[model samples]
Target: MESLVLTIPQVRKIVLEAAGLARKAQFGIGIEAVYRIIDHLGFVQLDTNYVVERAHHHVMAARIPDYQTEWLAELCEDGSIFEYFTSASGFLPMHDFRFTLPIKKAFKAQRKPLTQAETNLMKQILDRAEREESLTVGDFENDRVEASSGWWDWRLRAS
Candidate 1:
């Protein structure tokens, strides 16, 4: 039988290194570096608040010397990474997308079943997204009379 003990400093160093914060440029530079970092870390929380800069950008820039904010968008657009809720909202490597299925399932199970009208609205939104190639919440106006239902509710402007 054998056991190993770690000093406090040693444990702190280990945790920080695993989090990619033991030193600077841990993931190097450029968009490829961004992918590598996300793949290594598994998830990076995304924050839209920009008092100075977005939290996700700040996180990537701290470890990547040439990190650019646009790189995240580019990676997401190209399907190399994706943003979704997992404990918290964040970005995850595209390859890890399937691992989030359980979280999605749990969320759906806790919610009431969608009404037929809500289901129909969802189909309309999906169709619009397919036709438009891309869609954002702002793409639709707040014209729904049923009251904002949930996160997936898509508000459309009156035509």
Candidate 2:
């Protein structure tokens, strides 16, 4: 197969234009604009840091300048969109969930033999999730904690 090559400037322009088009930043906003944008871009990657604003929200805002963040939340609640890992935190079409299942299965398969205490910890998490409609790591308070500022530190990350 033959490959086409371009100068640095040409490559940069193409990349910039592609990035803008992918985000729909060059266009105007609409009520359901996020769906089109995410669909076009394939996935709206989720980010934890908010030194300015959450990544997903910022990405949507650039495209739908007049749209509200709550709209994205509603989309998630209505099951129109879903979150999955694609090299990063990502919001993708609900139908794409099937693609991520293999990753989950592989992760489960690779775990080391669990110590009895770790097994109990896993059991507690599952039991609570079964009882509660929703759950968080903060609910897992116990001696089995890392005793440091991480997920168990009770910080709510956007995903």
Q: Could you report the Cα RMSD, in angstroms, for every candidate shown? A: 5.1, 5.2
**Clash tally, candidates in order:** 0, 0
Which predicted model would earn the best lDDT? 1
lDDT of 1 by residue, 41-70 (tens): 999998865799989998888888877889
TM of each candidate vs. truth: 0.67, 0.62
N/CA/C clash count, model 1: 0
Per-residue lDDT tens digits for candidate 2, residues 24-106, read: 44545764677766766779899876898888888878667776888777878888788887578888877777888998989
Per-residue error (Å), model 1, residue 11 = 2.1
Model 2 scores a C-alpha lDDT of: 0.74
Index of the highest-TM-score prediction: 1
